[model samples]
Target: MIGRWHGLVIDCPDPQALAGFYEKLLGMIRVQDEPGWVVIGDAPDRPGVALARVEAWQPPKWPDESSNMHFDVRVDDRETAGEKVLELGARRLEGGGETFDVYADPAGHPFCLVAW
Candidate 1:
């Protein structure tokens, strides 16, 4: 069977902040907002990144640590995207080698930026 992933759920302390980070990063907007949840996407009527805030938020350990999953992001300019992401509250997690660099999102979820 072939399955298409719908969206990614990011757990964070502040849904608004995280959602804003992704909204700017992906050129998306807030589609839904609730007490403890906020979703951002290109189209409000379609599926996209879901930022779900929960009590007692804990960040995943990366590099030397393990995480359940991670996503790879394609960008036109890795340097520019890295800078923007950092400005948006994400931190550089890994140095660039040839094609990509790793970053930790606002809530410390690791993802990579690949040049497209």
Candidate 2:
């Protein structure tokens, strides 16, 4: 491969808060914390998630075709994971089945908790 995968970076109003949510959700450790950026992962050298602060950020609307992408997270128990995500400030979204459920993060990025 030309280059290895680094991480998925999300833009939000608060990098720290978003990073904290994902850190707990993904069980990843903080790798870098800066003024407008925060990175979390299994290790410093491994691929993970990054959050970047954006000025006047507008969240993507659910059920809209304008959305570009979303994340799918696999879990052992969908009920437990769904409850945990809601407790962590995620809002449930439409369009999911027995194997998966959709949610929007604090920053309004769409993601799914899947069990399959």
Candidate 3:
């Protein structure tokens, strides 16, 4: 590879809040915190998730053909993970089955909790 992967950056109206949600969901610590940017990861040197503040940001609508991407998180127990995410401001979406469940984060970004 020509370069190393840094992290996945998500755009939202509030970087702090969105980063906090992912930090708890992924059991990561905050690596960098700033006015418009926040990052969380296992450690400072490792690849992590970054949240960038975007003004006039519009959330993607679920089931819309124009929506491009989402995150799939692997977990040990779907039921437990589902409950936890719901408690953390995530709302369940329409599509899902025995092995996975879809949810929209507080900012309306879709992600999945898949059982391993």
CA lDDT of every candidate = 0.83, 0.91, 0.91
Sorted on lDDT, best first, the list reads 3, 2, 1
Candidate 1, run of 10 with poorest lDDT: 58-67
- Itemize residue pairs with steric clashes in candidate 2: none
Instruction: Tell me the TM-score of model 3.
Output: 0.93
Give candidate 1 regions above 4 Å deviation.
Answer: 1-6
State TM-scores per candidate.
Answer: 0.86, 0.94, 0.93
Per-residue lDDT of candidate 2, residues 1-116 (tens digit): 89999998888999999998998888889999999999999999988888999998998777874468778899999999999999999999998998999999998999999999
Error of 2 at 34 (Å): 0.5
Clash number for model 2? 0
**Candidate 3 lDDT over residue span 9-104, tens digit each:** 999999999988998898999999999999999999999999999998898777774457788999999999999999999999989988899999
lDDT of 2 at 56: 88
**Of 1 and 3, which scores higher on TM-score?**
3
Question: How much does each candidate deviate from the true structure in C-alpha RMSD?
Answer: 2.1, 1.1, 1.2
